[model samples]
Target: MAEKLFGTDGIRGTVNKGAIRPDMFLRFGEALGYTLRKAGDRPVVVIGRDTRASGLILQSAIVSGLLNAGADVALVDVLPTPALGWLTVQNGAAAGLMITASHNPFHDNGVKVFGPAGYKLSGAQQDEIEAIIQDPGFDCTVPAERFGRVVDAEFDVSSYADFAVRTAGPDVSLSGLKVVIDAANGAGVSAAEPVFRSLGAEVIMLADVPDGVNINTKCGALHPEGLSEVVRANSANVGIAFDGDADRILVVDENGEVADGDQIMGAIAIDAKAQGRLAGDTVVATIMSNLGLEGALSREGIKLERTKVGDRYVVERLREGGFSIGGEQSGHVVLADHVTTGDAIIAAIAVLSIMVREGKKASEVLSVFEPVPQLLENVRYQSDDPLSAETVKARIESVSENLGDSGRVVVRKSGTEPLIRVMVEAYEREYAERAVNEIIAEILKADGQ
Candidate 1:
């Protein structure tokens, strides 16, 4: 393992190479085992993975490292990422590891590590683990007598399902509603339908079958176009899609209208405020959230707190401010009263619960704002820092000035992907689109693309 192996999420990259190789995965687990030992004598590590061709090899390799390092292991094979964290907290394990690439294609994979408290490892903690993994003299195995053991974790789908059920509250019901759940052929395949069915909805499933290579292939939250057609065809009351690890969600309405995370947050925030469950009258979102969401929350007297573009950062701000709700535009909604991370299934339940409680369709209940016209485009570059170029800065400044108070321009590098994201929001679509295109052109010119 090299320095800064962990990305915005965790140690993710193309499998069999770079940070996600078998050897590196083992080292990550070994380092984690040592870290866990600092907390308890008999440290236990719980492992879960989504459906992918590389998941099996990676899981076994990680288990080997954990056992070699004198840590007991429980394997919840093919479970969602949040479920692993929940299991870690439920079993009181020292640490939790989830193998998934989330919305990435099957060729890539990752390992997300959580602490005993079920929250992600802090930045300092991640740095420490990386240091341990990189040290040439660090041992991967302990003495034979101190070696740990591994076992198959009892797959209790109900525990997580129960959490989702409870998130909707006792009075909420989906008795007569028709729902469609698109699993993206990943970890949510086993859990999504069960959770919805237990709530009394007639559920329709899409992309629920996982063939390893097909996970997240034109399905799930990242690409819900297909789900929209199904929802419209079936005339279902709502459609819900999840990423590979099931931590993020995207919603589709009966008329095939899709709502991004910002819309979801806006709707949920309004509902929480009406019910007086929105603690401190605040909502947390990442910097990538739509500007309209902030306006909508403001109209309801709910404050919108924006952190850097990550759900972990959003959750951190929520915890620091004693807030109860936070999320990202990518659909990573974290309800503090529910699970630690963004449990997409629970988020779906919460949104649907609002629909039932209001006796309205999803489009009606989730229509919390008239979003500002926005355009976001990514430009790939082979430079150390593409956005620092004089020409790029000039273009960004020019666009910001042109939009004036009615628009905004945000240009930044993606933490996980290799591109600079140019986001322009304006009162009109033409302005936003033009500004974004101009920025992309400037970036490409700078990169000599």
Candidate 2:
């Protein structure tokens, strides 16, 4: 097992390799169960997973570990990540474990742990779990008489759909809208249709069949081109595409234009501000959010608080500042009023509700601002500190100085993967592209590539 298990989201990697192996998942579950059992007698832990073939192996291993450790388990099969967290809180479970790799391909998988309040576990909490897993003398199994039970809780998923529908409020309805949803053949396959159809929208589904190996294959929020084409072909009012775990989304407008998280966050902020529902008149976003979002929100007397690149960081800032909304450029939006984590469905419902209330087309409502030209590239590396190289530092400094005020330069290592992400935003696309290439060249040179 790898010494570390958690990443920016959770422990994720290719199936049966590294920390993603079934044995590692079992150890993680045993550790978590041990902790939960220590906290409460016969503590219940809710579990869910996306539709991946490997999920069967990982789930069974973890459930066995949890049961052996005397932790009761409730399995809500094939549910979205956000729903797992919500259910954890609703059931007062000691914790919730969601097996998914979010937007990653089906070959990869992960396990995300949610605390009692439905928030991701804290770093300290993760450390404790790791310690338990790594301890050689620690026993994970309980006496036979102390073993806990496992139950299938599939029916509880409908309650989550009901809760998501209520996020749009009691009076809102999508009476005349034709909505197309691309579920990415992931966890949202079974959840998206019912929610939208209940709201009176004419619903069409794509990528909704989960054959266990097709999730995020040229579909979902990561690839919106196919969705855009379908939206235009069907004359749909809007198109929504969700990632593997359905915790994030990307939207397609009537003009076949795709709107990313920055645009969506800006529109939601403006709407919430107007409705007096925006707490602190602030929207939290990662540094990866487009500069145009900042400028647009500023025009509306709203503040955009920037955090490090992670929805967890954004949510932390939101909770600390009592803000109502926050998210990433990747469509992982957190509407604090409804969810403890990023929930694509709730965020989509919010956008749809705005359209219904304003009686505006998706293009008109979604295209809230013109984004500044931005270029992003990711470079994988094996070095321990590629950015520490003098040449790379110099190039970063030079680019930032050149793009001061009018543009921005962000270069950082990804927390979830061994890659450096380089993003350059400027008034002109060509300039942003050139600047990003220059930095990547320096990075490559520093890595001896």
Candidate 3:
């Protein structure tokens, strides 16, 4: 059987489980290093991780494997995922790896590898590494003389922060902005606050304390309710909530109403187009993006091109067309003009610049479009081929037909988790909710839930 380690993004799972254990991570590192060594001589691989308690163990093992394979290792400690990608290009290294599970809890950790150009490794690159790891006879041992040096590079983290600051452009400043930053207590624990404060914003930090276990506990992008409450209570002008790795974000308005990627992209796209900065006069998003966003962009004569789910694919589509803006509804916005990957801090700063330029309120600027009623539900199953089941297919097709032109239904297996997702969109709120619930119920029944 083929090595089924990589998913939509990278290898991710609960620590101590199948593909996330130390042994596996070590092998992953060795395989990655072994592969890179073939492409060039004296390959350097930079490493970073999040605040998850398991990250240290995994990082150490991976680093060891890389060293054994004769690849130089540079450790930046804990930082955002985008920083890893950015530093890959900055250091002129062969590759970069970030040990994180993103929005998943601390017990979960994974590795995302980036190529020299600061983008996620292409499918062919990942396939080569996977093949190496799966080969039972591959050699990972190396003589001591070939052992690569390891550097504790604190300056790399500082450079990424500096990069974030410069991403806001030379003319923009947040001098009077009172920004509430919810760092998710993961990688953002070290990133978001400094950038905002340095930009002259009065920062009220929330969920910034990462005690290993508290990375995403009711904090960050996944659970923005706490951020909303705090934003409302503090009367802060805006709230920025980052995922564990800080590659994505969700902005909370002053009223504590959370604005997702759809709203954020809507506002940014409008502003970029008005400033004549939007490349190709287009924006890219995933199939999961809100229908309202498509309509809103249409009104402005900007095309809303979509790809499959995953910010990696969005970034791929963005680069292919030279589009300047692209992202997911989950708030993984990619300003291709700046960072190669999604940088929540950079996206927030860009939006803050827009706010300053327009002299508008956070709510007024963020609420760029009125969203149509949409409902999504997840159904967990023990089998990997649930989507292939006849009952599940029939129900999904039935729902899709019911929604017709006035509505739509999206049913797909999650790339990161072992769950099937059903999303219903319609003009009527009750209809959308009912359709999603019914399909979820049917799937649960089919799976014997």
- Relative to the true structure, how large is the alpha-carbon lDDT of every model? 0.86, 0.90, 0.88
TM-score of 3: 0.97
Rate residue 147 of model 3 by lDDT. Answer: 87
Candidate 2 off by > 4 Å: 152-155
* Alpha carbon deviation, residue 237, candidate 3 (Å): 0.7
Return the candidate ranking by lDDT, descending.
2, 3, 1
Best of the two (2, 3) by lDDT: 2
TM-scores of all predicted structures: 0.97, 0.97, 0.97
Question: Model 1 off-target regions past 4 Å?
Answer: 1-3, 152-155
Question: What lDDT tens digits, residue by residue, belong to model 1 across residues 371-400?
Answer: 888888888788777677899999999989
Each candidate's clash count: 0, 0, 0
State model 1's lDDT.
0.86
Across 1-449, the per-residue lDDT of candidate 3 in tens digits comes to 65488888888888887766798888888898888888886799999999999889999999888998989999888999998898888888889999999988788889998998989988888888888888869996678898888965544877989989998888888999889999989898777778888899999999988899999898899999999998889888999999999999999999999999999998999998998999999999998888999999999999999899999999999989999999999999999998888889889998898888889989999977899888888888875576777888888898888878988888888887888888999999898988888888777877777
Model 2's TM-score against the true structure = 0.97
Clashes by residue pair, model 1: none
Better of 1 and 2 by lDDT: 2
